[model samples]
Target: NGVMNLSIKDIQGEMLIVSQFTLQAKTAKGNRPSYIKAAKPDISVPLYEAFCKSMETHLEKEVKTGVFGADMQVALINDGPVTIWMDSKEKDY
Candidate 1:
């Protein structure tokens, strides 16, 4: 049961997808983080919508999402403590 054999479509649970651009912040130069690597709103907005739509299509259900380009407060109680960070640019992450 611990095997990685499930996805959002296979799991019976609620899915909440939020657009977080700050995840691309670069802090190499100074104390203040730079968001230069993050995609611009013009490009990211449509991509975010398309991504959400794709998720809905795959899961066969409506997926909940936060408003784009809006200040949001998110609070979550993570039932599972496991965390995995993935980067597309780097291999074997």
Candidate 2:
């Protein structure tokens, strides 16, 4: 994965993984969104932990993560104005 090519350890960078079920939410009908595609806790929790562990293994450093199914507040300060989006299926970024 080109995104992972960067040496985060060398740069002393920190990572945060948030369980964003809204990514799978469907908003086709009305104002309310449906979460039919999002995995239930039984499925998503293990996968999410596996992902965080994988990141830690790859980076050789601890990776931070948010609560799996909690209402939480997040504050982020943009170090730069650039934003890049990548899709695994496309892999064209």
Candidate 3:
């Protein structure tokens, strides 16, 4: 609940919440990435749904989401070359 919510609200933006477990991949070892830190489907599914619901509540609009634990393809045109990443575990940022 901060700038992200404000920016989206100001722009009347719609959000697509995708459950990308790969974001938690650990790559310090070999060529293959490890998803050991990612939560299992049984745990993540509920959390994902809850997150979408929370966002909808805060945004006062319907939020779209992808199917959890499913192999899906996403397509989006990059508005600009910039990308930002944030992690809940790294709250100091």
Candidate 4:
């Protein structure tokens, strides 16, 4: 589900949504292509745990997440920040 679907209110301040793919990768092949299709508790359990914890630490608030599965239902109310992008380098500009 996209962030657009998530209903977030800045009752305190803005909310930041971080996306990390290290937990989802295909090391079985030479190149590390995304293996998100292969869902295994052994691999995802720790990753998801650390992810939620880190977010709470940084934001000092509960970081919500979607269920891990194809049949998961996602719905959100349209608010603001209705956009997206991709950042290649971590340039501190």
Report per-prediction Cα RMSD to one decimal: 2.0, 4.1, 4.0, 8.4
Candidate 3 local distance difference test against the native:
0.84
Off by over 4 Å in 2: 1-7, 90-93
User: Cα deviation in Å at residue 30, candidate 1?
Assistant: 1.3
Backbone clash total for model 1 is 0
> Model 2 reaches what TM-score against the true structure?
0.81
| C-alpha RMSD (angstroms) for model 4 | 8.4
Model 3 lDDT per residue over 1-93, tens place:
353445777888888888898888999998899999899888988899999999999899999888887899998775457588865575553
Tens-place lDDT per residue, model 4, 32-77, is 5876675576776677678778867766777776554434444565
After best superposition, candidate 4 residue 83: deviation in angstroms? 3.9
Model 2 lDDT per residue over 1-93, tens place: 564565667678888889988988899999999999999999999999999999999888899899999888988876557577656685543
- lDDT of all the models against the reference? 0.86, 0.86, 0.84, 0.59
For model 2 the local lDDT of residue 30 reads 100
Lowest lDDT block of 10, candidate 4: 7-16
lDDT of 3 at 72: 95
Best by TM-score: 1
How far off is residue 54 in model 1, in Å?
A: 0.7
Candidate 1 structure, TM-score to reference: 0.85
